[model samples]
Target: MGNNRQTLLLSDSGYDCENKTGEQMLEEAKKNLQSMAFFGLTEYQNYTQKLFLKIFSKNFKLAEEFAQSNRTFAETFINKQNDTVQIPYLEEIKRLNKLDIELYSFAKELFFKRLKDFRIV
Candidate 1:
């Protein structure tokens, strides 16, 4: 099952699969996984404050609970964003925002999917 899925992704992503050894294939797969994970992290870092604000506007208590339980630094980070002229973590955010459309899309989908877990549905 895993090999079938990997084959599909490799073809879809334009990998040249004809002569690659199994170790080579495995290394490529690992790299892809790491890249996707990095995208997801960058997406969360870039947009978590927006998510917090949206939750705050709708359900203040829930938002507070979420921050306290899941993101203890959220309030401080938001305050820094508001009080300073420069955005916090701008470089990290731009890492996703400026490159790799496929990775950006993957990160975006992962970010929005958290809305369900956060009970925003």
Candidate 2:
């Protein structure tokens, strides 16, 4: 008899849903976390929000660097650009947010593999 197992393909993830090595899964988790963190940072309006997201993402260095660069860019843009000018990275942030949501769902499924019948509230 042949093995009857089916492998699910996570949308846009390029990950084989079954038989993933632990390291590969860990790498995927890292990618998801970072993407989500970037989304958070792009939307953050205050220091408290940034700090919370930094903790959630477990990437202090990235958070610090991003914060500094964002501040510098905003200052420069405001000083040089008029209100009619559009910020360049807004579209990139939107794209990342969409991708992050998908990755987050994929990670959730990977996390609850053993409890497939259970629903997260």
Task: For candidate 1, write residues 36-108 as lDDT tens digits.
Answer: 4222243254346545656465554432432323454656666666445446565555443332334435445
For candidate 2, write residues 7-108 as lDDT tens digits: 112222344535664345445655545454233233233443444444464553442433433455667766776545545655555454553454555545
Candidate 1 is scored at a TM of: 0.25
Model 1: lDDT of residue 83? 42
Tell me the spans in candidate 2 whose CA falls farther than 4 Å from its real position: 1-70, 87-97, 100-121
Q: Candidate 1, 19: how far from true, in Å?
A: 14
TM-score for each of the candidates: 0.25, 0.22
